[model samples]
Target: MASSASSHGSINAADHSPPPPPTASAPVQAVENNLLTPVALSSVSLHGAKNTRRSLLDHVFKPLVRESASADTTFGDVLARLSIANQKLARYDIFKEDSIRVFISEALEQPQPGLHLDCTNLDVSISVKEKSRLVLSAGTDFGNAEGSAYTNAVIRNILGGAETLSVNASTGTRTRSAYNAVFSTPVNGNPDLRLGLEGLRSSTQKPWASHEEQLTGGNLRLAYLADNGDSHALAYSGVWRQLTNLAATSSPTVRADAGDSLKSSIAHTFTRDRRDRAGNPMLSQNGWLLRTVSELAGWGPLRGDVAFCKSEVEVSGAVPVLNSIRGGLPSGISVGGGLRMGVLYPLPTGYSLTGPAQPSRINDRFQLGGPTDVRGFKQCGLGPHDGTDAVGGDVYAAGSVNMLLPLPRAGPESPLRIQLFTNGGRLVALKNKGKAGEGGPTAALDSRAVVNGISSAVCELADGLPSLAAGVGLVYAHPVARFELNFSLPLVQRRGEEARKGLQVGVGINFL
Candidate 1:
């Protein structure tokens, strides 16, 4: 052993104790999960806002910043604030999809020394990519009753602050020609409120009524969204309508109403949608929907040739149907029901409520029955008819109940399904004693007659089950709309209502 020790050096531990664990000039801080840790927002900056206005950004971020300035605010809370701002920007339709991103880091510079020195301060940077300023497209539109090919031009963020200008032109089978221009902007830089001005011209053929309606008009509207996801809209509209180009087989009711009329009106609409999925019948297996509209025409400052008070309400609900035997129904089946009702009451024109009550006109009346409404009936078919034409009605009530089943071997993600449905409705016209009295300074309204007409109509609606239809169909939920092909039969119908016997194809965004 003495000889080996003489030949080699012996190993030993360092005497410096790992150099005092590598001490720093300042106190070391532990890295933490910033998301859960409390922190202070020292500053926030927005990037990629070339087309946006500074004032609009201030309006959106001022409140959020004030909230985040509290000492207890966590980094998670700051992220939530950023998320909300991102949503608003996306909703403005001025940003590219998924183009918003956030970056967080330690502040390069700290605020002046303060009592809250224990709080860690962080900086936030939000980056967003704007969409193209101009967009043009040509496409086709399939509405509830009409289909058309259209060309659209949109100017996004035209004047900054998410303002938009849109122009559209279209021609179609039912709509002979149409053109419209609209300018819309956020009110006071609040995305939840919008103000819009629109001008439109259209010539639409109503073959169901054996007439064509030409319209030249414009409207100013203010739309608001509440915190609970309800929407409200108020609009003032002035329109000039001409009923012309009558078919050879036009009905006397249609012929009598063929002329030019002016309508100056104010309207309010309220809507609430609480569906699990919007516009997807198979996926909307829970919750309810409601919409109401009220309008007044030719009253007070709004003076025109047509005078009436109109109200409409629609409600629908869906519930999931479960099967206990198999744990649940395959693909989550559902049952849904809907009801719609409308009324048009005559009102005196001018400032004098004593004037003779004007009758509801054809242009202002309601027409029920269609694939999107009541199945097995022709478009505008469940209403008053004269000769071969559907003259429409002043009051109508429609309802439908449907059950949807998943296709064999199809999964819940599939949009195709089988549907069994039953629907019924009735439309009635108010009996008018005579036309409006001419220049009625001395003429007075016959309140008794109006009351009687309304009462009779209501009594008739309550007298029996409405004209009924039953059907089975295949439903396809398209991304843009819903497609349905049904084999329907009219279980019961009125004398003049037109019922489609065998197969009917329907396409639109809304359905009963």
Candidate 2:
């Protein structure tokens, strides 16, 4: 009978016909006879893993193959097992690349004298090229919120455990200065589970909002990855926040929430990402992302300065358009758009909106504006403003639509593009804490009076409607960030609202 077998340089497999049933006529063969039987892992050799511990590799590889004393494994089964092990090793991220080779080998011990040849065993050899363990990087970044120079030092394969440690620092005009250190490691020897700790300090000046904030915090995070390309993370953070340098023109509401406060909360984030690349998505790709953050303060040993629940959902997709029209437009031209909506509601913690002193904090409020947000408006330019400062709002909604056009020489992989976009959004303060004094009149503590007061506040907030803007821009989607120069005009505006007209330049990791 004729048989065929295929093998690759990186992986190997062989097919063998079972020896003719022990012919009684032939001389009794040795127990070491070579016959077609399931293969057993005899030994494993690792190359180029100098800094990695042998035990670590064993932990990652040992469970991958079952050790069956009975020889009943086939060559194909060995290949499949090696493939799975290779994937697990790649997830460590310590290696530039890795390959596994499998081959048949003789068992170490002597065989009984009743068989023909040496017993066959499977041997797995893993070869990996370690990536640089340490790296130092520095660069300058520009964006609508700030322009800054940043530097970072990173160490991989920390303590030979495939862990990572990094320290970063940055200084800029709007962000002032910031520093952070982070350490991450696999959890309980599971590559798919991770634990991280972070320490951070930063100071930021918001010129559009006329306030400077100083923050010092530490966080602990745990993350898990599922087989379906989904990830979940849970974190606990405690920080001391100080808001100062409030301009004299700042609103009374802003001044009330200004001061040092403690924010201790727990948050969870789930993400399902299927995009081809995260940095700059392809024009013909389709993907959606949903993030919901629920935060609770004063849960344990921390101060309950603020409490709120915020959730946001965004979906984006791209499709080929005008492709059938030969001469009408370029071949790669496509239309891409996304929808985003978010809501923020303050949780009651005995903090009365109508009290002499409210517990709600200003830094916790939501602010929307800038070229990355609602374009055609200055930074924090949308929503309600206190004098010239944007105080932000308790509730806000924003949506945008955009068209992406390929540049003259742009290819599917090229990041250059021309884009046209229109954005609209609204921000509103749900209850007027400024009217706390008004509840002291006829029915001071009466429920009827409280009901009327909330009605009045809602009525006052109705003055600010949704604002709309449209613009055209040059977008360069780089692997690390996106750059844009746009010219925008507001189609609708509110009196006293500051709108950014004409050319506006922005640089950041995301575009709204």
Give the number of the best model, judged by TM-score. Answer: 1
Per-model tally of clashing residue pairs = 0, 13
Mind giving the per-residue lDDT tens digits that candidate 2 earns over 103-190? 3344454433322233355445455677899999999876655679999999999888889999999999788899999999987667
Q: Evaluate candidate 1 by giving its C-alpha RMSD to the native, one decimal.
A: 12.8
Residues 231-259 of candidate 1: C-alpha lDDT, one tens digit per residue: 99999999999999998887666767788
Worst 10 residues of 1 by lDDT: 1-10
Q: For candidate 2, which ten residues in a row score worst on lDDT?
A: 1-10
lDDT of each candidate versus the true structure: 0.79, 0.65
